[model samples]
Target chain A: MSSAPVHAPASNDVIATIRDKALWIRRRSFQMVYEAQLGHPGGDFSAADILATLFFGVLRYDPERPDDPGRDRFVMSKGHCTGAFYSVLAAAGFFSESELSTYMQPLSRLNGHPNRNYLAGVETNTGPLGHGLPVATGIAIAGQIDAAGFRTFVLTGDGELQEGSNWEAALTAGHRRLENLTLIIDRNRLQQGARTEETASLDPLDDKWRAFGWQVEVVDGHDHAQLLEVLSASPRGRGRPLCVIANTFKGKGVSFMHDNVAWHHGVPNKEQYEQAMAELV
Target chain B: MSAAVSVESGFFDCRDSFASTIEALAAADERIVTVVSDSVGSSKLNGFRSKFPERMVNVGIAEQTLVAVGAGLANGGKVPFVSAASCFITGRALEQVKADIVYTNVNVKLIGQSSGVAYGELGPTHHSIEDMAWLRLLNNLTLIVPADPWQTEHAIRAAAAIDGPVFVRVSRMPVPALEHAGAFEVGKAEVLFEGDDAAIIANGTMVHRALAAAKSLAGEGIRARVVNMATVNPLDEAAILSAARTGAIVTVEEHSVRGGLGGAVAEVVTAHDPVPMRIMGFPGFLPTGSAEWLMEHFGLTAAAIADAVRQTISRKR
Candidate 1:
């Protein structure tokens, strides 16, 4: 594992400090994608801040003990955004940061999808949508079964919600009253082909979740402090699951890619990559 | 029909045997858990649910979640058996079966109930003729298709005892008990009958058909060997080779002709010693009919299988 970065706090004090680190991860992730000339950069950029906050501020995990039974679990249901996940894991001291350059290279452990067999810190292999929620539910149920205090969190995309498996898990989790399970939807409206609204609208999303028996919380996903507050709070209603519907841009930090449909899986050219990096700095 | 002396006991659905065996296993071990997709009553698992409510997780009407959740439960150190209709379990949740259970090498038992044309009236949507092919493509998965009630019980026990992923295809169609009272093994093929002219190998519900076909061949002075190959993945290469040495081999199954028991046996025979062979199965999508009618239509009946074997034997000379 590589040494963790030592950094000076930013001017905005608490929020900017976390935002700066998140921006750094986003920049590095973009560089890897650009270098490899392949990756879902839009989703990664959209999800970077949440990843940074969870790994650095909220999640109760020890990098040294990835398999600690008592540690809280995180599942990346939108596994195409693994560029963001790998960058955060590297920053959190799970592996060498230099290894991020190997992102889609031949025979690289970092394949198109995150595989648990070759990497630590990956809870499960999830490229296909709607798989993470059920697995996360199982983790939460396991904690309840063992009488452990560990919590389980899963992040999914807005369009991925079209998959019916998520609703199945949602119903079961709420019915079981698994207070330890938290679902964080990175509600970046754009999907691979087009905007989620144009494809299959998942609006009334929060109400749908609430109706399915979850305590729904809507928040700005990019706001580090708000994310931390909502994430750290207790499960809202008794005998129900928690759903944090974090409203997010398809591409958050990069000026050119932000809210741009074409950037859903677009790799930046050299000049474009440089421009994005400069904005981050 | 009078009870045949060859069949030990009366007819019974293997799903019953599976549930009873699983209930016994769960009682002995606290780690054993059952996950169903609203199929508790259909799979004959109501007794299991009543006995161990905590261990029974019924993710109603969601096959994908059922399978992925079973993988997660396995990851949590519980040996989970995910039970569902074979068509839905194997077809709908194929990616989960491949990624979560097989690729991840999780200790989850995927119990595919009512396989083949068991749901006759429900039409092609419910028929699971392609499950064997789909499951066989996955690596590190032990595929066991039990022939009868006794075999089903033994398969469940063996799967629970094994420490990795296993897929047991249980049938809702009634079958006479074929195996002796206490003789069952996982990867070993049982030689039910010995002959020198030709060999008939079968699996799942077709094992009895192969046996009957061999008995029919005996009347014509054409001796046919019968091998019950319950395990499809780790095929009994020795038995297959021995059968190939007899100059002709015939494979019978309730699955599609492609990538099933027939395909598995063909792969083995072709590699070891190329021989004249006849593969019997549903060649394509079958029309809706009664289970028995569908079996006969697909040439899965004993007489049809014997005729095919005889044709292959004649082709050898």
Candidate 2:
């Protein structure tokens, strides 16, 4: 399931391998959520492609040297989607893939949220919404100060943006013109109980980020080619941060679950799990 | 007993010492950066700003960003010293302090300025009395309240030397320099006066008042011991248990009576020894006035503390 080297993006093999890796991530994420019974499958399925592409086809780091200062940082700010986040990390050889069975078990290295202290690839602990961006901005600013060539990437749930702390970090990041920072919004219209627009309108979302002095990029979140192309691109806006609006479906890849808000955190029964697995396979 | 103990001529503001120490630390180590919320003048961090302008990140009145930025800087291999008004920084961005700084175990120094009733005239909105209670619950965060400017300077240095998150609370009110015999340690309390009758455990500006209380208690043949418990999180259990063994104890703090230093000491004392104790602090909000007036209103004075010690001794088993 390993993708071709991400640093060589010009090759078509990289795109093909990434597509395969994205499927593996989606299938594995579904399995993890089914076992955990207490997880966010909607957001997990929605952000699967973005997470998969970033780990396999974009981020630069050695699994052996998890603490290497030179490595790029990716903070999963939308922490509820630990199912997909941990699945991709295992796919990338961060830990034994067999350990995925231990998800949500007591004392498991994989908690409900990503804990950087426990997991190697996790950059910071994120469970409460609106935390990851500010910390990512801090890491980016540090990279700038140290002249460290590594870039910082943070993925936030579109609904999580309702929390004010994200905007606070956004204002600071844009004002500082943090060129090494990239913010990705999982624009899966569905939230916990309702559509993001029905709950709290975030229409013209791209314009909102642009107003905060960031270069906005709208892309198909589930498209690996698009995610790799946009993420791997050199931060174009000089003295400005980059924000990618990744439009995706809540329960992507599975027929019954796709765009269904009920699956936000609803665990599948045996029949539903089998049907979902059949569709994913 | 109304004893007139003459006060000293020289006084120093802990904030000034904090700002100067930040500058010195930043000069010595490039990793040190000062993050503030445009309180350079109030926080006295303009010295650090003037010297290393790039290192001074003023997020401009945003407390949440101030804390997150500090956490980020620490993640980036920089030792960020976040300085802000204790109330705004701790109260406004408590979640950030809890999640970004403490829970993650990042190496960031949070300098909570003008803690306690230092902003008494501004009323309860600016009061940072609840900071200790709010922060002590979170794990991996070190809480240190320096008694004076010298202790503030040393605390900042000690916080920098550590590898995880720390909150160093400093008062805006000028305090007289104290004579501490032992070296400064993060969690260990310093015993200034030794007495067998009862112990007065305090921190920050209250430490000096506790010492004064012990002095006045001596007049009544109540030999009270005084302990400067600077570190609140890792409560000096050895000192507290020892004090509890004496059958009488009084805890003082410039904070709320409940869920603070007194609460911390009482937790250990009640479980270990169950001594007769009187905790001295603000029972609740006070009427707006000067810091001195507020202290008196809350019965937070040397004489009042001495009185509490006598009462505890009277009930001692």
DockQ category of candidate 2: medium
Per-residue lDDT for B109 in model 1?
98
Q: Write the per-residue lDDT of candidate 1 for residues A160-269, one digit (tens) a residue.
A: 99998898899889888888899999999998999899999999999999888888999999988788777766553456778999999987887888899888889989
Q: Give the TM-scores of the predictions, in the order they appear.
A: 0.93, 0.97
| Clash count, one per candidate | 0, 0
Give me the runs in candidate 1 sitting further than 4 Å from their true place.
A1-17, B1-9, B180-183
Q: Each predicted complex: what DockQ?
A: 0.56, 0.79
Candidate 1: chain B TM-score equals 0.95
* Per-residue accuracy of model 1 over B130-149 as CA lDDT, tens digit each: 99999988868999999987
User: What lDDT would candidate 1 get against the real structure?
Assistant: 0.85
Best by DockQ: 2
- Clashing residue pairs in candidate 1 (N, C-alpha, C atoms within 3 angstroms): none
Best by lDDT: 2
Encode model 2's per-residue lDDT on A1-281: one tens digit a residue.
24344456546767776777778887887788888888898888899889878887788888888878888889999998988999889888889999988999999998999888888888888899999999898999899877788889999999999999889999999998998999999999988889999999898999999999999999999888888888888764467899999999999988988999999998888899899888886
lDDT of predicted model 2: 0.87
